[model samples]
Target: MLLRMPTSLSEAQRYLAEGAVPVGGATLVWALWQRDGFPEQAMSLRELPEATLIEREALGAAVLLHQVDDRVPDVLRRAASTVGTGAVRRTATVGGNIVGSTLRCLLPAALVLDARATVLDREGPYETDLAEVVAKRHLLLGLRWRDPVTSGYYKAPGEAGGPPPLVVATAVHTGSDGRHRLFVAVRDGYDVISETVPCHTGPDRALEALDDTGLGSLPAEAREAVRREVTGILGGPADR
Candidate 1:
């Protein structure tokens, strides 16, 4: 398999149009390679101008997970820190994490922060919600968001060295009316649920949103256990 390394956005797009899979950091690409399921060619975004750009309120897709630090928000930094071992964190790119099949550790924070992605596709450049960018498998260029007032994250581990069973990320935003509101994204395994509600509303809203998918598949006791643990992390039951 050939790796196409492009030095410009236009060159990257041209390669993408010709069916070369876009690669950043190559963590996911390596995983696919190990399984022998990766495509015959991949276009590396490392040399492109967008790869390492980090502004006050934005991060380029190619920014490594280890690079998410105090310069970024606490919630984002915390989530990125927990993703993998030191070596994997150093090699995983934000864009690859977002678009990967299994929801990586970074997405819940991105979702709760209301992040928007800047993408370049065969159709050309455009901006859209990060969720859509992931859903559509767009070639992510970078992500942008207004500064959140405050944020938090929670994870329920499965077993030693295994994937977490649940993760919740929260952000506090002040409305135009000047009241703080809470937004949350809950990841139960690979599925996710998000909601916006009054501040301190707790985990019920997001958990209920996951009913038909994440929570529904679990046994009754297990669901209750999730509710209890998430509630402890998020605070008292929903005020509403």
Candidate 2:
């Protein structure tokens, strides 16, 4: 396969339009290539200006997971910190985590935060919800969000060096009327449960939000773990 490193967003878009698959960290791309062959042409976004920006409310697609710090919202920071070993985290990119086929911990955090992604296609850059971008595997330029008042993330333990089966993330943000809005996202494998309600909603009500999420389809252990973690995160007593 031929790899082209584009230095500008337009150049990258042109390469991508010409059928070159976008590569961020290549952590997922390499794995896919080994298993099922990917596109013959690949464009590396590393040199583009959008690849390296990390700010108070915006993050470049190629920003390393290790670069996420206390300055960012708590939910994203905690999720990034727990993604992989130090070495793996150092090499993984935010965009890769978002668009990868694997069930990454960051997706739930992004969902709860109501993040928006700046995407570059053949036309140009356009802002859209992060979840849509993730679903379509679009070429991402950056991500932006309104910093939440409070947020947290929890990843259930699976096995050493393996991805967890369940993760829960919550965020509280003040809306235009000065009332707090609570957002919760639970990810189990590829299925997700996302809900938004008043910040004052009780823990029992929060757990009830999962009733329509098809939570029963998951394994018994994962179902219980999801309930336990969601309850604990909402300040409820753990199941006996």
Clashes of each: 0, 0
TM-score of each: 0.79, 0.82
Stretches > 4 Å off in candidate 2 = 34-40, 161-163, 201-240
Model 2: per-residue Cα lDDT over 33-134, one tens digit each:
888987789887778887677776778888889999877888888889988789978888988888874765688888888888898899878999876887
Model 2 superposed RMSD (Cα): 4.3
- C-alpha local distance difference test of each model: 0.74, 0.77
Task: Mark the 10 consecutive residues where model 2 has the least summed lDDT.
Answer: 231-240
lDDT of 1 by residue, 52-101 (tens): 67665688888888898877666788888888779988988888898874
Clashes of 1: 0
